[model samples]
Target: MLQFKLVLLGDSSVGKSSIVHRFVKDSFDELRESTIGAAFLSQTIKIKAEEQEEDVVIKFEIWDTAGQERYKSLAPMYYRNANAALVVYDLTQKDSLVKARSWVEELKNKVGDEDLVIFLVGNKLDLCEGEEDLRAVDTSEAKAYAEEQNLLFTEVSAKTGQGVKEVFRSIGEKLYASKKDEILAKKNRELGNRVNNSVDINAQRPSTNDTTTCCS
Candidate 1:
């Protein structure tokens, strides 16, 4: 079992909590309330591949952080020990993506040389077409920014539950593989210790199985 921490950062009404709910509970709230400080949820994802099959209990300890300025300063605390991040924005709101961009920049600057896997997700994609002002928040904008930042990008809708599951599933698989590698390394170390112990036992064994009287 792997416990992977993930933090979701985005402006209010951008569907951070919605995405979490959609993935974890498989339900959506139409009259949802804004997130308080942060919402935490955990879900395990089972993955199967061609080489081998295993149940990857990737505990997605997700933090649906608040986007309010008052809570912005505290946002870093949630991501400090996170394995991955999903930066979300509302496609119906252009300013939200701008705020999301600033958050990404902050993560980049503060994260230093450590490898941070970030996914740029735009929510409310089902509301893609509308008036000119609403249409301004193009999916390409988020996609371009993610490309520049070397982040995985996707658009989803919590209302319709479209592309919602895939986004987290992908992240879960990634974190699961990373956890599996560590597990395999630990197992190998244990095996090596056993081998060394066996070698020591053989070295200490007395060669008295058969006493042979031979001319030396």
Candidate 2:
């Protein structure tokens, strides 16, 4: 399996932990407490391959980081070598989206965009159902910003599990597609090294063809 580190970033109470729990455990907690520093979780997802017989397995080593200002300094440590990131925001708060954008900028500045996959996620879709006035971040506006920044974008409801699976599924598929060759090449190299280092114990034993008696 190919493994990658994924990080979650956003303001406090934007449902970053809820998103992780929803995706990894298929459960939700209404009163989930704020993350202290960071939490680590891992989940493996398979991406169907049209050109291969076996599905591509991607294991995401997820780091769910705290969003409080005090923990902001620790975010860099969590996101340093992350392969992908989800910058989440609440749809009910426009300021949350602003904070999400700052997180995105920080990621691009610190991590660089070359090999990092980023998603701008607007959470709490359930809150806006029927009560459209509750939505402060316009879908079109967020989508536009996502496009401008070259990020994958989606809105999800962690409580209701709407669009939750799709978020991680898309990440798995995209990462597999982008890193398949590199991952395969790395595996091949490791296999080759193992083969070359293998010792032939049978070859080291004294040959039976040697007829000379040892007791002579």
Candidate 3:
């Protein structure tokens, strides 16, 4: 399986842990407590490749960081070597979106846009249903900003399990596409080396010719 590190960043109560739980366990907790420094979890997804292409499995090593201001300084430690990031925001809180954008900028500066896959996630969709007025961050506005920054974007409700799976699925598919060939080549090289090493060991064993003692 191809493994990648992913981190979540956003303001408090934006539902990062909720999203992770919904995806990994397919469950939700309304009273979920806020994360401390960070939480670690992992989920593996398989992407069905096109015809003649190799099917790939991606394991996401998720670092769900705390959103509290006190923990902000530790954000870089989690996101430092991450392969992907989900910058989440509350759909009902405009300020969360602002904070999300700041996280995106920091990610770009620290992780580099070329090396990282980022998704701008608007969480708490369940709260906005049948109550569009409650949504403080407009979808179009967020989408436009995502497009400008070249990010994958989605809106999800961890409570209702809406669009949650698709978010990770999209990330898996894209990361596989971008890194598959290189990873495959590296795997092949490693396998070749192992085979060669085994052959060399066998060759070093006492040969039948050497085993035959010379007659007096």
TM-score of each: 0.81, 0.85, 0.85
Stretch of 10 with least lDDT, candidate 1: 203-212
Per-residue CA lDDT of candidate 2, range 53-156, in tens? 88877778999999899999999998998889999999999899999999999999999658799999999999998845589889999999999999999999
Clashes of 1: 0
Give the count of colliding residue pairs in each prediction: 0, 0, 0
After TM-score superposition, the amount by which residue 114's alpha carbon in candidate 1 deviates from its true location, in angstroms, is 2.8
For candidate 3, the lDDT comes to: 0.88
**Which wins on TM-score, candidate 1 or candidate 2?**
2
lDDT (10s digit) by residue, model 1, range 1-216: 456779999888889988899988999899998888988888877665434465545557788898778888889899887888899988878898898898888888887635567888888876774554455476676778889988889988888899988887888776656555666665466668677765544224322221223542
State how far residue 173 of model 3 sits from its true place (Å). 1.0
User: Least accurate stretch of 10 residues (summed lDDT) in model 3?
Assistant: 204-213
After TM-score superposition, the amount by which residue 12's alpha carbon in candidate 3 deviates from its true location, in angstroms, is: 0.5
Instruction: List the lowest-lDDT window of 10 residues for candidate 2.
Output: 203-212
